[model samples]
Target: MPSEQDLRTKIESGLPDLHNLIVTDISNGCGQSFDVVVISNTFEGKNKLQRSRQINNLLKQEIAQIHAFSCKCYTEAEWSKVVV
Candidate 1:
């Protein structure tokens, strides 16, 4: 089981040029599941599957110890559009 902060830090380090990251524990504080949002320039040229694979590889270890995991990745430009 990995805490939100732990996963956040791991992702932050693994993904360079990170614009934003949000890690939520969806397992009711049990740390068994997580939902993550990642925004970074590193993902600028990638498609959805490519972005997800990057995250999945980065969190492979932590993910193995958890039950459920979901991630959404976007470039800073893409995120701004979504938020606006």
Candidate 2:
């Protein structure tokens, strides 16, 4: 099982110009499930489904091992609103 930090590292390495990346281990200490929030300009002009597919593709290896992997992808502009 990958640690939360390891998962975060993989996500950052796989995505270019990634910003405000946050990954949470939500498996109640099992370390097998994760919730991820990613903010990046790379998501610009992409719809929600497209953004999700891109992230799913980027983290294919990690996704395979985890029991659950939920990701929320946002463009910089969208993230600003979500935070506030």
The numbered model that scores best in TM-score is 1
Candidate 2, residue 17: lDDT: 83
lDDT of 2 by residue, 1-84 (tens): 777888788778888888789889999878899999999999999898999999888778878888998999998889999889
C-alpha RMSD (angstroms) for model 1: 0.7
Off by over 4 Å in 2: none
Q: lDDT of each prediction vs. the true structure?
A: 0.93, 0.87
- Tens digits of lDDT, candidate 1, 9-77: 899888899999989998899999899999999998899999999999988899999999999999999
TM match of model 2 to true structure: 0.91
Tell me the spans in candidate 1 whose CA falls farther than 4 Å from its real position.
Answer: none
Q: After superposition, how far is residue 7 of candidate 2 from its true place, in Å?
A: 1.5
**Total clashing pairs in model 1:** 0
How high is the lDDT of residue 5 in model 2? 87
Clashing pairs in 2: none
